[model samples]
Target: MSASAGVVVLGNTYDFFSRTRPRTVRRLAGRGQAKRARETAEKLLRDIIHAYDSVPSLTFRLLVVEDVATGGGGWTFTAENEYKVSCTLYAAAYYSTQVCVDDVLDQILNVGDRPGSLVPFNHTTTSLRGVVEAGQWVAAGQTLSWDTSQRGVEEPRPCIKRLSDPPIYRCVHEPEGVTVAAIRQETGTVLQITLNPLEYCRIGKGGAVFTK
Candidate 1:
């Protein structure tokens, strides 16, 4: 499946210019104007969120400040403070539609059949039911799931990973379905769930259901 990425920017454009440009009397006068533009952008972001939040499935993350840069272009007299205010607050929204498409691609690639079903594993009351270690051999079930309720993938404690912790699958019960999906959590918990047929389903725990 095709992967997607997003970026969000938030800050004062005028302030940025004022701080970076060759300071002088004329640039000082434009400070107030730059502030207003920054405020306007902030308000616009809020309004956009308000408008879309009414929709049932709409969700977003403000990943501002991940990377900041400054640049300017215009007629000669453009001072740093006078440079056009360009502070931007960015956010990304992924809908159910895109998720469905990803599922299709995973199926075609036979990702489910990969080693270790790659489900969620962790130690949280809400996630793993307070157990330090939990395992199951269900023909299906989610070993783990993530709490992406927070914004940005830049957190030190990421919800997803290429590595596994407490690394072992101790099955308490047979997998419920033919396919399974493992989701990692921010709190170090792994959520493993069995997937429906036609999805990226894993059958490593051994059962001759059908061909991949």
Candidate 2:
């Protein structure tokens, strides 16, 4: 196997810019599970966006992960969103829409090509949670808006239909009437659920059922 192919954490998850603990993410990235890193990063970003009002500091660091590939290295700072840079031959700069991201960790931060176009550094003023880790429990403090931001893809969504039983999930928008969806967990540890932003979802004790 290629031992050189691995993801390394370069920064901390709590401090906005602290170095990461080596094994904090080795469980996923080291095992060739890059998707986990991406998901975790996205969740963190969403959490920030959803709960930024109660959040405290913006000075938290990301789990700066460096994924080494055959061509070069892909550097990712896993936060609320996966922010990273790619290189085909060596260190280059390319990012994705992923939740939210910054630059190449070390780069020239500037605004438009003019002093008048210069945009001031933006940071949300509202404040609780800082950097949310994957699998961490986030309080459902606010009512989920039935807008585009609340929707999920055509995939199963986590829900809490029955607290006494294991977690139940469902999906919507296929062809016709309501149908059964898949469940991701064998236990009821999930406290949050996914909502399809495009359609209307009816959530009850039975589970989350949706429609177009």
Best by lDDT: 1
Q: CA shift at 117, candidate 2, in angstroms?
A: 32
lDDT of 2 at 156: 24
What ranges in model 1 sit over 4 Å off? Answer: 1-30, 59-212
lDDT of 1 by residue, 1-212 (tens): 22322211122443444343423222421345433544454454344323323323222222111111132333334343243222323322211112332232233124333344232222211232322222322222222122233421222222222332111101111112211112122122222222221211111112211111
Note the Cα lDDT for every prediction shown: 0.26, 0.23
Candidate 2, residue 13: lDDT: 29
Summing lDDT over every window of 10 consecutive residues in candidate 2, give the lowest-scoring window. 87-96
TM-score of each: 0.26, 0.16
lDDT value, residue 181 of candidate 2: 22
Predict model 1's lDDT versus the native.
0.26
